[model samples]
Target: MSQLANIKQNIDTIIGADELMERIRAGKKLRIKLGVDPTRPDLTFGHLVVFNKMKQFQDMGHDCILLIGDYTATIGDPSGRSDTRPVLTEDEVRANAETYLEQAFKILDEDRTIVRYNSEWFNEMSFGDTLNLARKMTVARMLERDDFAKRHASNSPISIVEFLYPLVQGYDSVMLESDVELGGTDQLFNMLVGRQLQKDAGQPEQAVITMPLLVGLDGVKKMSKSYDNYISFNHTAKDMFGRIMSISDETMWDYYRLLLLMDEERIEHHKSDHPMVAKKHLASSLVAMFYSLADAKHELEQFEQVFAKNQRPDDMPEFQWDSLSGGETTCPLLNLMAGTDLFPSKKECRRLVEQGAVKVNDESVSDPKAILDKPADELVIQGGKRKFFKVLG
Candidate 1:
């Protein structure tokens, strides 16, 4: 593929493609903007789709402006929200913003990327300035957003503050004088708001490029922590690789197209190959991208050992199993998970059991509430695809 074609790969929409292309042809470095709200401390693979697009711009000799939307996050984005999001305190926003910046370095080059916080200017602006910004967009124009319209038509409680989110987000573009803004397809309206707001401010309007939202491992909803379907960048490399392997064969194509960016020919090549082999290639390649090549290779070896070789890993976590009071053989299933700190909480353990992801002694856990008798020998626990532990009596 040509360079421009490659850059445009997997792009959902580009608001000002011609002008942006013209600028690219001119060989001038453009300032690209991608605003992220730190409503959540961690990013999912869904967010990586946009980050990879920004990485492409950086490679093209353009400047990347990563705007941390500290102020707007407080109001919460109303783009795809069905109901009003809870208001956040300034401290919460700042705390999450810090984590966002720290984790962003995983995909973005620290030296080349310019990070800015909307709170820097939004905090300094007076109420009058905020009011002026709000006047730039009419209520009808704001209603053009699908989510906002649906809520209004359905008579759902649409918080008044929610209306200000896109406007405040748009002001960040004017402040940054962004030449291009990158966002997910869901943010098309907000991104267009940035383009118009910049022009209204007598600045060069930013071109908007939106990428497709990556589907989670569930192969349905968008990848997100709230859905419990997200693959977190914070997961262990082995866990990350294992989760990739769990995705359905069809969903792997979505992963390749959106996250992996394999061309049509290469993707078809994978389809002709064995599904397991293709998935391993995709899994290890993704692991290498997020972590390292060595870690990816080691993880692949571990996966093959457990699944193909039918053997426990050489390095499994060990947990001590104490007999119940009075030498009783039975123990609460939740107690073993909790006592060992195998799970963060009883709730998570219950959830895993309900999902049929928790197993003890190679048997599927029929009941999270069931008490298990003490094993005569070493007990093995396998939770989810990656978590494994050995219990010693």
Candidate 2:
């Protein structure tokens, strides 16, 4: 297919496909905008769903703008929230913005891409300016958003700041005069607001393209850091490969299609292979994307050794026994697992132990309160299916 066809291949919807195509054909280097709120420290594969589309435009020689929502992040995007999002301090938002650019560049072209922070304009604006921007949208229009409508119907508390989120986001397009905007389907309302604001400003309205949200490892919820099922771009090669390999066979196909951008024919080609073979290929390909081929290869080898052969990983991380044991002669199994940082919390470690998910030296330890003797030699500990660590006294 042609590059233009490929641009619309996997998108959920495009508001102005014809106009966008006409501009592209007319040799106008369209300014494509993708705005992201740095509410979290890491960008997940879910964010990658839209970034891939942005990269497609960058490759086609359009001016791709990576709009960092440093200003909007303070209010938090209320697109999918049922309640008011917790306000973030300027310091917190700025710090997240720094890391966001680093992770975003993994998929986006750094040299050719144009970067802008909404703070550039928002910081300069006064309360009067915000009120003027707010006049562009009505209260009825703001409540028309699904999330807002649902909240209002359910009598859930909706903050006035939440109502201003779309208007603030919309003002961004007017300021930048974007030609095309890319986002996930959840951001459709906000993107439409941008288009309307652009039209009101007498600038050409931006064509909006919304991509599908990538399902997380659970195969249920959308991939998000809050869901704790996301694979972050900053994850180590081993963690990244292991997490991908752990996804269900059913979910692997989605990853193959969405993350790898494989067409249906290509997906069917992989589906014909044994599920394990297809999954390993998917894992290796994704690991290689953020990291090197050698890193992916090494992780694959370690994965086989640990899971297929039931042997310890060659690169198992080591922790000092004293540190984990807290200088005690014995350490509670739950505490030891939590100290390794493999589990999110001691409560999660306890749950895993009760479910027989924790093992010491390959022996299942089902009791959460079980204690391990401070080992004179290195001891291999496994937490859940994917984590392994060596504790040395």
Top candidate by TM-score: 2
lDDT (C-alpha, whole model) for all candidates: 0.85, 0.90
Question: On residues 306-381, what C-alpha lDDT tens digit does candidate 2 reach at each position?
Answer: 8899888877789998998879989887878889887799899998889998889989999877988998898898
Q: What is the lDDT of residue 324 in candidate 2?
A: 86
How far residue 103's Cα lies from its native spot in candidate 2, in Å, is: 0.8
Query: Candidate 2 has which clashing residue pairs, if any?
Result: none
Query: Candidate 2, after superposition: displacement of residue 149 in Å?
Result: 0.6
RMSD of each: 2.8, 1.1
lDDT of 1 by residue, 156-180 (tens): 9987788888888888999999999
lDDT, candidate 2, equals 0.90
Worst 10 residues of 1 by lDDT: 319-328
- Lowest lDDT 10-residue stretch of candidate 2: 1-10
**Candidate 1 — which residues are off by over 4 angstroms?**
1-3, 322-330, 338-359, 363-378
Model 2 regions more than 4 Å off: none
